[model samples]
Target: MASPASQDIKSIGIWIRVSTEDQVRGESPEHHEQRARAYAELKGWHVAEVYRLDAVSGKSVMAHPIAKRMLTDIRTGAITGLVFSKLARLARNTKELLEFAEVFRACNADMISLAESIDTSTPAGRLFFTMIAAMAQWEREEIADRVKASIPIRAKLGKPIGGAAPYGYRWRDKKLEVDTEAAPVRVLAYELFAEHQRKKTVARILNERGYRTRNGASFSDGAVGRMIEDPTAKGLYRANYTTVGESGAGWQLKPEDEWIWTPVEPIVSEELWERCNGLLAARATGRRPAKKTSYLFAGFAVCECGAKMYVPARRGKYVCAACLNKIPVDDLETLYRSELADFLLSPEEMSAHHAAANEMLREKELLIDAAESELKKIVGSENELFDLYHAGALNKVDFGRRHKPLSERRAQIEDELPRLEAERDVLKIGMLSRDEVLEDAKDLSDKWPDLPWEHRRQIVETITDRIVIGKEGVEIILLQVPFGNDDELATKPLGPRFRGDERY
Candidate 1:
């Protein structure tokens, strides 16, 4: 039966929904609202309000709080009719759509689908709506079948099916590739965690160094722990892990064999990745005890026994939990300083730096000479311009215009001249500071008994990369201080690489 004209809704609520993607299927929230508004306006229905579910998808319609709130509004008769651009925006599943339809009917509310021109208030319209719903559901099922068949293939081929790329990587060619800037931070984080076996400690160090995660957030203990344990770091991708929930919406993990494996460029070595995961696993079960002292090389030293070197509550002893390796703290410190104390004091070590410094010195001298020549040319040009103006060979305006820029250029060069001359022999500063550190360190020997423990420790730590006390005696990996050819070592930035038992 046809409804009375008086039963026609005079006012309606405008509902717009957007997917998590900014735009899905080329449909934007604004475009959907504009189209719905035009249709409602054609029937002379006033838009009482607009409700948007923006950037929110993936949740079931029942679980969407906003959707529930809308239901409450409809029941209370806030608007004559609830209108959306399409039925799919209301609910993806036909079952949920029917539930929503029943709610509208019970509320004595009219629902209008702008795209289908279906008004549930009319018998004929309701019948058409049901038929459309059935067909749409069938179409959705067919689409799902196609997606299910293809998505796994994409995953197995090492392609990112969708969503954001993992940390230390960016999406390129539909695959995850190492992000140059973030990859180092990720690798360094793994190294730090492997050595200290503490996520909180590693997080603190990374945060202090101004490193942030992929989301531009500071690392937390839990976040760092999850990152290290993630297999994606080692380029072994896992896919098909999540499947559609059996009951309805959302996803659940599939059986292990269903997981997809993909290969990508690894940021950290396999051993480094394994060590961190092992430590994370161990810490999950039982964390190791905290050290009682913060010695000079506290967390910076490693033992060949595969455990971090720890100084007991007593200051002069180092012990490794993994093996019977033990060392007198004094003997270890003495050996480290003797072999790799100050690179500046060693003629062989400083030779490269000295050569680089001399080259820089010569370059600066040539720059100064070039600057003087340029300055003299500018002055001569200015003088010639003035003589030409006096002889009327040039106009005053032209002379002023040309002279002003040259004068500014001359002033700029003049300003830069002193800074150029004052450029310190870069090599000398690098060498002297190093020599001073060693000389200061030498004073910390037993002969200088007045030195405070804290001071002595700081001096030693400032120059050392890490002190590895192993069966191969004491190996001290000093900072690779190169005055000249500095970029050579700097180019290949590494956190720490472990080759078999080698510790750095």
Candidate 2:
């Protein structure tokens, strides 16, 4: 039963979207469009236009050109009823789905999903749409988490986990197989890089010698550097090498130990890889690359004014271009390591924190049990009311009056149950292993001078958000990642990480 306005709207727009070409046997774009058309015909509505977003991933709504055009048309009220084969085809995420709903509602357009029989013209249908959209997003995130979790499992079993096969290898029969043509190029690239101690020189040599990458592209210095530095080139798998970055900063590199490593069929010997990397490291510090003084934290460090820190050739001073903030490289590294050393909780503090977590967990469990008991009591009351109504103990109006509040309370508790259960899991807190932090921090703080600049950089990158060089002093923001909350870890200390010598 449509509204008079909706029934009078004869022209309906059909939207068909599929993420990949590998759709189910009868789930092609044509099949979906046909279904929408059939549904429109049954409603006695004419087809306005078929909007097909073929082979478009629903991950991003704005990425597809047709989707943008469709939304623009929606905003302009060009279409009456906007119809889709399925909700997932409309959008993958809840926020995007809600935005679509808002746009449609604003344009006074109805949205119809044929597969789910959801018509936004009805209140219940709108509610169902929101719930389904949220459920779909949660399911997607859970599936992605499971997939990401399986990466280390795959690596442990010595399997390649969905990255491009290294330059010298190709995936064959679900394994890394040495590429005959490209293997020699990888070998030669390393040999040249080791001898020449430069990626540009190796790139030129490889190109001049008619050697190219697996993609048949001429070797660029960056490409050559990547090939030489990659552990995958020497037949090793790397997992968990990335960590969540600061807001708006993308993923950052983690410590080497955080990265899971497994062996693969060796393309080059470990000795050769070591020699090449060692030579590469020697060049990183000892030699000036492209007439620029390469600071250990060049790209990794930022200033208070939010500009990148760079080292000038003359004075070994790390200067911020925007604010002219300066700090000596040695002093900056020392202050950073000192701040990091203080990150680990003491033995007594950690013990107390663990105790608090256990108590909190127990309290949460009891609270959930109490909530569930109350919910069950309400259910029992509702059943009693229904029984009375059936037995002529109450009139229909009275029955409705008694049932509404009970139903709302039941719905509220039912909705809250999942969140409460999730909180319980989140509260299943683990003790921060001070020893783990101590070993790494101690090594970085006390033993860094003996280590190479490359090793030092790798260690520094593991926990540093960025070194903000303020006029007051250098501010070091360490990546804490507090066990229960992420925001708790984002704090900066009251004072400078440490002060440095006066600017030259």
Candidate 3:
């Protein structure tokens, strides 16, 4: 039904829904909200509220909380009218549509479909509602048909669908490819599974190596086991059926031999994949015992005081052997957490720093161009020297001496070019915006103790070349490089310091 043009629409309610199943789909809830608001404004309707539901099914309106509230608002005369992106979004079932229509009629509110152009205020609009509802049903059926058609084609082509990518491989451009950086970690998983027949042990090994999921999160034992059993690593895709439900008695796994063998860039050999699965099965059937460990940071933490931080024979405290810094484990944890909050720069300081750095980069680019031109002139002179020698215009000894010096000069210029280029790139990055610098500073400071010693050393080296601890405090000396003979470039600090209590 079309709404009466003369009917006043004082307030409107917008409902936006996004199914969790379609979470990976491009459009977000925010996008839907924006569209709804714009449509409401175009109609001169004042938006009263917006109801958003995530990961909820659209098939049944009764199952959704927001859908129930929308119905209640219609019954209580709270909203003058309700607006949705489309009719199917409001209700998928025709019977539910009739129920909502009754509520709208009783509350003196009208139902409007922005996309369908169906309003309940006129007889012609009433006739259009039935057609719009029918069309919505047809559109859904067509979508279902298309999905069904595509699934078979995808399955026949041996393409993975509706699940996360297998370990050691990432999904890209609609195909699976070997993740180079993660290949080594995959190998380690296979080795642990085959040798020790242990899932927890493999997880520990991966954790120690700093290997994480695509989201940079840790994996559980079941996740590791799933990775080992996945057939994709062996360049095959099996269409095995596994029932999903609550009762263990009802669900069973069924093998399908007509498995698709897709050509995937294998991360490990077929033999290794099989061996790991076999060992994993053996362990699952009680053929192997689990290993135990007491130290959480066994292979992860390190002392910065040029000492090997070790757990003493007694317990509960970590001690640095070289510096004799006997810091309790709790103290170290406290320091890590406290320092992060203290050392980061404020947002305002970072913004100013970034602007200054950008200005420096622009100046550096001009200097580099001038230096390159000067270097090119020197190269031309060297070419002239070579030409004279080749024409027998100069003696061999003279030519050799002249060529050697020119060659040395060319090499020097070539080396300097790289340095200048590096300086330019760094300067082009400019100073960190206050937020960015603070974020990074927090990460470094917060995770210092938990970080592996090597990573800690790198962070320290990046920020400061040397740290001399005094009775009063610590003196941090940064590594400042001279850009060139220019006094201005040579004198500047590579990085600005965030003194303990100073704003970023």
Candidate 4:
């Protein structure tokens, strides 16, 4: 019974979301769907699909798979409009609501909320939607302020404020207690630091003795330093002394006057804690350690047990503190360089790299061409609309209504064209970067002695990802040249010289 013009007008999707409160109130999802479907029918629009978020919280649906599918549908032009019972039903999260609006706007799609009477098909409706998003953002900020205000007060009461208990401690029934298994290791760390007066040395000794952190990770110098500094090990727990900085600036210490300290069971005596900390203070004021010369693969080497290999002061070999695994610096460099040469020089690898690059370029070009063709058709349609309006075929009101969608679509395609072109340019540059990496490897193979230290180091860093030294042999892992699958350096382990027993 629909006219051809009405059938071709709009392809809309229904969005139904019923929260627990609404469900308890006897508001069924089917009620919302039927309302949206009737509205779509009245507007002479096709009901393309129905996206249901039944019983899902509106606070955060952006991470939900159904929500993602709805966004994808909008982007792919599978649905040109979405009809929902209300804005809050779509998402109560201000950020998520704003994100949905932005995505719809970007895709040149409409969002119609029946309750609010917002139809983004018109200019006034778009303005109202913006105002609603701004109000929601304000509400979110108010909630965040309330949460921040409670943190200090909660800390003063000795309640479990938030976050996991410190190392060697666990929370049981909202109370902090020493973890018996980790407590002994924590105690040994302080004793070792008091004796050696070196955090790295203490960490190394603990690791070699088969001791691991509560998280089952080999102890690092930084981890040992933190454990030593924590007052929790000495019968006192400190909180409200630091605040997290905005945007990943990391934690910053609050003023000492505001710090809250509470007493708890001790893992080590305060005397032992003070003695170890005093030695650390003395070392801080003393002459710094001499800077060791950099090796060809200083930070790029790892032990098979997942510990980084480091050269100790006055040592000529990379040592794994965890398992006492050792590999000569020169041997690792020679082995890596040889593997790099084979990877870069092989004809098969070169062919595969070129083929992958070409395939990506071809796909990008096809997309660019399709976008250009779509833009052309939109522009042609705009010309026809103007021609019809001037020739008295369409009146002013009808002309304006029909032209708005075409204009919005043209803007979207115009924005998308440049982005596709930029991606094509990046793919071309990526191919060139891969060629340069190959050239660097070739130069390193032929002119190792003649190249500057910095040049050789740069090449090694670019091509080699890591060198793993184990009891059996060495495994050389190379970084993928050219945005392709990691040409994982041959997994077969190398000779006995790379074994743990080899030492300087």
> Which predicted model would earn the best lDDT?
4
Candidate 3 regions exceeding 4 Å error are 1-348, 359-371, 423-472, 475-504
Ranking by lDDT: 4, 2, 1, 3
Position 112, candidate 2: lDDT: 79
Candidate of highest TM-score = 3
Error of 3 at 6 (Å): 79
Clashes of each: 0, 0, 10, 0
Query: In lDDT terms, how accurate is model 2?
Result: 0.62
**What lDDT, from 0 to 1, does candidate 1 have?**
0.61
Tens digits of per-residue lDDT for model 2, 1-504: 122222223456888887664374335576566556655543335566678877777876754667766655554334556778678889877656765775565444568775565665433345555664566446545645665678688889997575677788777764567888788889888888767877999999988988877777899999998888887766565556877888858888785435555445677865577556655654654522111114666655667787777776687877876777788877776666566555443455335444555565566678779888998899899999999999999999999998999999988876665445444433331112222334455445566568786456545433344667776676665433233533122233423445434642
Q: Which stretches of candidate 1 lie over 4 Å from their true place?
A: 1-160, 243-252, 287-504
lDDT for position 435 in model 2: 24
Model 1 TM-score (2 dp): 0.27
TM-score of 2: 0.33
List model 1 lDDT by residue over 234-281, tens digit each: 755555577799787798767543555555677876556755654554
Cα deviation at 279, candidate 4, in Å, is: 28
- Give the Cα lDDT of each candidate: 0.61, 0.62, 0.54, 0.69
User: Residue 56's C-alpha lDDT in candidate 2?
Assistant: 76
lDDT of 3 by residue, 334-443 (tens): 44335334434345534544455456667767777877797788888888988998899988999888788778876776655545544443332212222233355645
Q: For model 4, how does the per-residue alpha-carbon lDDT over 1-504 read when each residue is reduced to its tens digit?
A: 122222224577889889888999867786577657655653445787888987888878977878876766665455668988788999887667876886676555778876665666543356655775576456546644654576577779866475568888888865678998888889999999988889999999999999988778999999999889898998767777888888869999876546655556889985577556655654654522222226777666788898777777688888988888887777777776666666667787667656766766777678889988998898899999999999999999989999999999988876665455544543453344445657555555777767787567656544455677877778775443335432211222322234445343
